[model samples]
Target: MALRGLPTPLPGLAISSLLLARPAIAHDHHGGSEIPEGQTVSVEPLDTTLWIHIFVNMFAYGVIFPIGMITKSRWHVPTQIVGSMLALLGFFLGHAHGGREFVGNNVHGLFAHILQILLIAQVVLGLYLKGHWEKGINGFIRKLIRPCHSIIGKAMPVLSWTQMIFGGITALGFCQGEYTGQCAAHFIMGSAFIAYGILLTIILLVGQVWMRQTGRSQEFYDSAVIAAWGCVNTFTEHHWGTAWVRNDWQHTSMGIIWWCAGLAGIWMSRDRDGNPKRNFIPGLVIAITGWAMSSHPQELMVSEATHKMFGHTLMAAGLTRIIEVAFILGDKQSLTEDGRTWNSFQFLPIFLLYTAGFLFMGATEEQMLLVAGSDMDHVAYILILFSLASLVFLFANMLVHMYDRLANPTSSKEMNGYTGVNGRPMEEGRIRDAEEFELEGLTSDGEADDEGRGMLRRSQEGHRSQIQGVPLR
Candidate 1:
């Protein structure tokens, strides 16, 4: 038999009641339950506030999604959609669980939060699919699109920073008398956002400096661009997880490590005037240092859970790095008489190595999680690691092929004696001789037919006599 009637919690009323009841229980002391005690919980009012913030943020993100679509950068479009959805989820959760006012009720604050999500999403998508996007777009569109994209792209990171600033303002204003623990969490996450924002700015500046110092070589420029993107991607991911306290720091650190490795790789491959090998040593050091630092036990002492999470992240990052390095090595250019050929097959070993490392890392993480009875976290780690591994493998293979094609030189057309645009080559020596003779004829003849004829005859005779070493008649 169906139950005749069951009472369900009211929205704002329930929350207000709980808030009113919380202080009374504070003195009673069962050490407090997971849910805050005390408060005259009201349902309707709190629900209204929650809905307002949710609606505004969603509206802002909705605007951004269309903007992304119109731009036609496939990579960015997906991320925009995904981020919007995530923000929507966050908004709903905040309202349902009671913390809507902490996000602010003002239109401006809502706009800023939306902008923040949009910018972060764009940066992540751009970096993750950098090379692919560059290749996927039509050549004409690439040329037409890139300038506009660059301007907007450059502004995004700065906009993200601004959004963070506004978020801080909102946090301060809204959280004043609210839940202290939640407020503290917001503050910490906000700080991470700020830090990563600064890092992204620095990465852009460093790329500019590297470009200025290295000249306009495409390879050098592309490498720097890739590295800069990597930094932005790493930061974006960290920010995505910031609201969730249980995120693995090791994963964030590994991303940072990859960013630094890319930077070092770019620096190493730059054309130095002398002793280029010296640069390689330093570059290698930087890469190794990044990996070591990322995997270090700084947060492990905090808890066994943190240690396992961090360890999994670091292992995944390291394996990914190895795969990248392998691709680079396999794509090394080899010079031949016909031109150059890239023996990309050389990377096969490294590719296998990466696969093995990824498998081993995944297994180790699973084992650790099993021992700790944290299956959910372990599963998350495995998924992330697998996703990254698949990406690395796919890209590495594609890059190897691309590098080979780029390195292989095509034969130039043979020059014919005749001259025309896209037709035949005109010899400079022959052209100059003809010009000189015409000038002499014009100077000597001076537009008099008979005189010009006589001068031409004399010139020919003199030239012949000089060649034969005898007087001409």
Candidate 2:
């Protein structure tokens, strides 16, 4: 499913080429120092300090910042402050590393500086917005900055994700020279998987209304992107003037299938009346891609194992998506919603995609080699990636839940012990209560009046018999 060894539009490829083009004898004022022209540098093993820095920063940006944004209240301030402090500490630790001495302009370090500046700007904006000024130019300025603050707040986590990927690659000194193109393909496509999973979760949790308003099935958007990406992959995967190798053929053919399947998906996403309709073409395409990737030949056993797991996870994601759309949801959007609760079965595919993304990202040759050199086996490495995915999945769900709680606060009915989806109260005893009182006001004609009188008389007779102490059978 990836371009394998083709160049991409990402800037990382250029930076990597610069880093690997020359030897590390002298530092390039702006770029990092290079290794000797013919000498090769082995991948640097991660030390305890580096690991700590990674975890601290990942937690701050991935967990705390997202939660802060979701809260968007007084709690937001403190949560972000804590996250910022942790991130700052991680930044310092990154520079203080002794295991790897990156000379000249370190890509990871440069990105960190940019990230920190953005973080500072975000904090400043938040503080200014908190002042609550009014009736002055300050108020107007605040109004202008409010949206900017929110936009930055939302963008920080995504930016942090990019920086984190940079850190991983930089730390290992991987993705250089010929591997740069492959790095771009793996990271870009992996991030796409994660982004898709997140988008689906958002739509499942809180965007149902917006989705319904779009007047198009979810598959429409999915197919559109797939088609667009496939078009790019088809043209760029192989150089037109060069001899087409096996890898190029595989990649280009996969791209061909993607665009073909995507078009079918778009066409089937509507009914005869032009109403939105669900289709499984997207899922089927994903499954076929996964199958191809699982059987893809690799030079190393470690790589083979990693790719197999990644492919299996992807296959599972696609299959689960099909099951969710076709069986669980009956080819519909969603199920009955008395509350903002999702069917338990719905999360399976999202989490699988998340895991699949991590697996694919970790399957890079350098990363697999690192794993092979470590004490851990492929199974252990895979499990660690799965664990990371689970944590991310938890954070995503929690953030979405926080947003739902804020967007749809408790109503008077809910405050009085009634609660359900879309702020509607539960209908537990409503029907029985309505039935019991239904005939009370029906006194329109003779038959109705006679029936009512007969009921009254029978009640009176029963009371009299009870007063006489007689057993009325």
Candidate 3:
């Protein structure tokens, strides 16, 4: 009767079957029907102390050590050396701090970390062997170090790539984490450090290879000078936002220093001969442009009342221009007659480009200031000053060119022999005679022709007479 009231029970649905089905339906409802398989476990975060230690180690070993090897200033050497030592100390401290944490938290990771450290140490040692410890009592030590240094030097590119991969993995993990502030900072700083390390490694390798190829260890020093200048330029330009963080004094001072480096590099690379006048025009233009870009006062967008300035920009521009011009002139002066003409007008194109590019760049800066809600007065003032300076330099160069052209219209065709100061023929009669003698295959024995013979005999007689007149000791 109960089955009839239910209107039908399935043939397989007995009381036991119904009871078992109830439990299965309950399990499904409670999400216990199936278990997930092969899920990935999350990696634990690295200890903060360990991270900091690694950061410090990287800065010291990767940055400071390489810099010391490159820079060689008598006055600054002690300070740099001391700083490098301090960085090394910091590296060890950080490594110890991190190593302890790594040992406790990540037994397996500890070996990988150690391997990374060892590789980095190898690179640092190689750099030291190649530069800092190349000479003196440690020379024998260097001999032993050379094979390792060579191996590491070759492997640097690989190491750099590995670092990048690790850094990217870390960054990805950080991005996925809930600690937004800490993770973001970690990701940013880590990426930046990795990038910097890669660049440093590349620069070191390049410098080493360059030294080997040129057989000029001094070239490494020269590259260091360029790097120093670049750093200064970067600081002045506030490339890393240094200007925003630091006081004007710091930026200005740094800018000056960087300009000096550029100037020094230019001076060092100069052609041995002097004649900077022609080169000066282009140099002046570039200098003026650089100055306009860097130091000319422009109102800040955030604060119209405040002005943004970078003195180093102008200083670098000026010094670089002068140096470039001087080098050009020097090169021109040293050229053979055939090559001199080729180099003569080289400065002209450089000047034209400088003038055009700077003019455009300055104008762009002005527009940027305007968009930033800066006061037009400051912009106008800067524009005027920059334009005036540029014009003055341009006119001065033009005047010099005009004067040169006027003084010697046929200067180019004349094999650069038309010196305005001295209209005397560049090749004297003696030089012409020597050239003619060589062309004619004549000996100074009164032999080629009657005229040549007479001239040769007369020259001999005159020389003999002069010698005879001088009393013998």
Candidate 4:
């Protein structure tokens, strides 16, 4: 995962060779069909109104909601509330016009319904906060509220991306019939979804360690399952023991490596001397995720090169994390928060992706480039510059959050104000640790049996503080 020591020649050769030999790559990867020599796929206008609705859906749910979650400003709530309503409206309209046909499959329809429920639930949570009261909800439901909030909250981005990708895949191309061929757009974005999933797994594991959850048999169980899948994906993607590993394959291979490292940590943790060393796995995870997206074909091309630069920046941050973890653990200190706190250095990669995502938006415009440097397009370059401006905006927002955390920090008594995952302020004072979040049927005070709900340790006065009502009128 460390870019400095790892040789790049293998991946470089793989990319170059793939480009030169793509004709023979067996077009069986995506589907049996192939695009006629010079044709390409594109976004459609089921008319202007449909096009506008979907983009608005994408921007509101994918962009604005996530940005609010990342920055966690109080001002973000009003905007997010508005965006949620708009996104829900858009979902209904889009579904009526486009997604209705897919209901027979059950998969897409199920997810669509889940997303709608999540949106309604989020709106309810926002209003509850605005009300500054929780009498209408139950104590246990309130205790489990943040975790529920977090699951749906974190899911919105992944769910949005899923819907978008499938929507694109299922829709007829603007200029053609069904697009049953390989889509570069789908591949790139789909890989990001996988990458984000792995990251959350690692972050949750690391968070548990910092909070002193030493008894982690369940944690190991989860890691073992994820690693097993990674191992399966490794072979499935053709990345094992091969001389030339494709960049996409490298991603799965690294997932395998990360899982192996995690398994090692789990085994070692039983030795009583391995507590300080258990964090190496997560550090390596960050490093791998950082570089996994770097080794693609257009590594040095226009915005493609910029994307690689973005990848390396994340790699550097990963290396820094590794070093920091070593230093802190060596001195018998706690592990740093990953993505949950305003004070976390863990937010770095998230920021990198958002800013870099815009750059990649135009990187996909490579098909528009003409022959030779003389006829090349400048749109991607302009977008790359716009991405940098976005970086500045994000940087400024991060600075404000850091400043706020310093200026108006929360105490253990005010656990509700911490805004658990994705900035959804908890309705109940029950702040469950991320470790046992998945096992819903467990008490926060103790582990749960299979049939029981996870009992979250609701704060008495420690969990509740004086509430001042804000007039919604």
Candidate 5:
């Protein structure tokens, strides 16, 4: 199961890479009448400079920086330094691109300015932290700025995600007047699904200890978020004092189900003794929503087929989630005794949600109409979208595994029954190594008072304990 499920997202990437290498079909003009005036369709391929910029920044933000955030190895500093350099280079190429010019005030361009400023600030803070000042006003300033540096570093990837989305919208000239609401709904919801999948991945891989500490089942948080989102959707999806359209009715009903199911899920998230427990309400809600969406009315055949596929994919996600909980995991927190190993079937729901997100995001009315005009069938289009999903998932897993490797350098040998020079398991050696690293950084002078040393040791131990579960690699 692991072998089959793990490689699912890779074929999409391989196929999509080959497909993308082909020259884009040229259209005299963008096909849709809904296209806002002066907005250009992506009929032509992007300029070489823009393509280079996109890949460089994607590698930096999507790959390099994320791994850097999760590791505490000697390589962390150099990794971040390389990522920073690449980001700066990407920023330069973005401005220097000589492709077709945007006609209006470009949100992508405007947002780039803000992102660049944040990047510069992050780099400066990193330099200060690395400087390791421990005397005078410089030390005081560094202490004050340390937490801010960590916070900003963590936030950079999310901001980069938004900026990257804006870049795509800018290139394709989407999210304009009248289309803004649909565009926002599709993209934001799609991103939400993808984010949810990532969270699940994190938990499945290295979050078992954190889960135990929470004292609440994962469903508790999941249901709480669902209920909150449902409440917002129930009100915002339809305009007050206006006759409800078919879409408004359908959307509102889906929201109603979410909140109703969510409340039930939250209620069932714990056993009688107050211990965390699993429930099926969230997965049921997802399946029902998909069922409703599958038959969504659409004028174009392409739109109809695409919507059905999206709904089916979503339905698969929900059903697999149910299977994983009810059958595979038997409603337990984990399948393995130590909460380290997971059944491969666990990945089914995750990747399905991921695929469904891309499908829904790509099934927008304008995008569908465009595909229809280009003589492309729904199957081919959906496959291409799946390819994109697969590529993103592949990157996500790679980042997680890289972090696991760097953070628990000796875990593999320990798993294979190797002992270190001290006749201790390599896991113990890893903890000792980490303690020494932290002590070296925290205590500027080689010698510290016993009290200070004890505090630092406790702090390092606490940190290590939190992440002591199995490494994803």
Candidate 6:
């Protein structure tokens, strides 16, 4: 526990370093196993820099991007503006590491640099899109921007997450003179988050498409079951003690419970109709487990004050979703679907949870909380501010979608109902009286009715706004 140059991220400070029950602290805390004799670096961990850099990275990618993407509001470009600034700061600090970890025989320096260069390209491309080009070429540029923006946007975040995974394994690619290894638990949890993000995204995309076409809700059922198994793993597996591994043997028990519960939920969710929305246990399981996992209270209130509360927010969101379903509010769609709709409001808790996780990861690290930890604090503050700004946009979007965002409120199930050939209902001959069923939220021009008053109408945008005469992404 030597105090040297600049500090690094969570696990390395002189004071007791605790991150989610596992110590990601540098060398000396636990005499990690050594690499081959020829492969020891004289590098140091940039725990403090990482605190600000990586935390900001996650916040921008996980929270703000999604908000702007969903809403397409005036704040969208500004969100990118703030995000790009944070990224510059991160890259500056990341470069401060000076490739120390690769001084030894085993070098991952090349991989790290490649990732950084790619990130730079993504940022430049983003900025390029904001600038205007000549008219004839502008259309061509816009075409390029579409695929480029969409692909780079998706790739960068996943790549960034993967880098974090590597950083954890390599302890940010720097250690004193010797390094054994950081705890494997941290690695496992990071992997789990990555898995969670990817799965949630896939399920949401799938669910959105499926619901639009078939109107069956397989996404919710499957997601809930997965959440249950994860919950069982959390409660039964995490060995939470000041010291000792008492339940070393019980590691497999919770995993088994997870399996059984998931299988049972899936099997029982069926009523011989192959329908998915008949049961709500899967959603409940995910909600409860999310809350339960984040429920651990810290013994000390100094650094990680709202540590438990971070998890609680996500848990609360899940619970709110369940309530929405039970009370049969307008929130009856798949909870994790990424598409924007009124039902998406129920998914806000998960979004908040992800943001809060970024916040806690930044602010609570003992190293990040040290004297002169202002940079880390600033990064955390910016992240929060961006989120708050995004919230204004999100709240308005939510209000606009408070009723039947998922489907046309006036659409009849019987119209797209089970009455026709091959389950596809025929369109009625014609409307005898068009005004009799004019549709709930539309004008004759096919734009949302904006002249109306009320929260729903006030929040509604007749159409997406243009930036400098250009349509926004």
TM-score of each: 0.31, 0.78, 0.23, 0.47, 0.81, 0.44
Arranged by lDDT with the best first, the candidates are: 2, 5, 4, 6, 1, 3
Worst 10 residues of 3 by lDDT: 1-10
Clashing pairs in 6: 7-48, 8-46, 8-47, 8-48, 9-47, 9-48, 11-25, 32-180, 33-180, 224-282
Looking at candidate 6, what is the lDDT of residue 464? Answer: 15
Better of 1 and 3 by TM-score: 1
Whole-model lDDT, model 1? 0.38
Query: What value of lDDT does candidate 6 attain over all alpha carbons?
Result: 0.43
User: Taking the tens digit of each residue's C-alpha lDDT, what string does model 2 give over 1-473?
Assistant: 23363222343354444334433343332245344443233234556887899999999987888888887444667888899899999988876654444443555666778889999999898777666655589878977998999899988888888888877776666776666666767786677688779998899988876777889999999998778767777897888999988988888888888888889999999999999999998888878888888988887777888899988888988998999899998877767534345689999989988998888888887787778787888888889999989988887888888887654543222333545565444332332233223333233111256777678656655644453463212
Question: Candidate 1 residues 1-473, lDDT tens each?
Answer: 01001011122232223222222221111233322222212211335544555455444443344334333222345655665565566455543544323322332345456565655555554444443433455555556654654565555543443343334333323222344222333233223322322332222222323333444432343345446544654564445634633233543454465467656656665455632221232224223433443343322222243333433443443344344334443322222222222234433333333333343323322234343564455446555645645654564344333333222222122232334355433333333444454554454324445676677667755654454453222
Candidate 5 residue pairs in clash (backbone atoms < 3 Å): none
Judge candidate 5 against the unseen true structure and give its global Cα lDDT, from 0 to 1.
Answer: 0.73
Residues 417-473 of candidate 5: C-alpha lDDT, one tens digit per residue? 546565544665577776766575446433467798898888867866655554533
For candidate 3, write residues 154-254 as lDDT tens digits.
Answer: 45433333343333333222222223222222223223222322332232222323323443323234334444544543443344544353334443444
Give every collision pair in model 4.
441-453, 441-454, 442-453, 442-454, 442-455, 443-454, 443-455, 444-455
CA-lDDT, candidates in order: 0.38, 0.73, 0.37, 0.46, 0.73, 0.43
Question: Model 2 reaches what TM-score against the true structure?
Answer: 0.78
RMSD of 6: 14.6
Cα lDDT over the full model 4? 0.46
Query: How many pairs collide in each candidate, listed in order?
Result: 28, 7, 2, 8, 0, 10
Off by over 4 Å in 6: 1-110, 114-153, 164-209, 212-257, 290-299, 302-304, 328-340, 343-345, 359-473
Off by over 4 Å in 5: 1-45, 411-473
Give candidate 3's whole-model lDDT.
0.37
Q: Give me the candidate number with maximum TM-score.
A: 5
Those runs of model 1 whose alpha carbons end farther than 4 Å from true positions after fitting are: 1-100, 103-150, 157-473
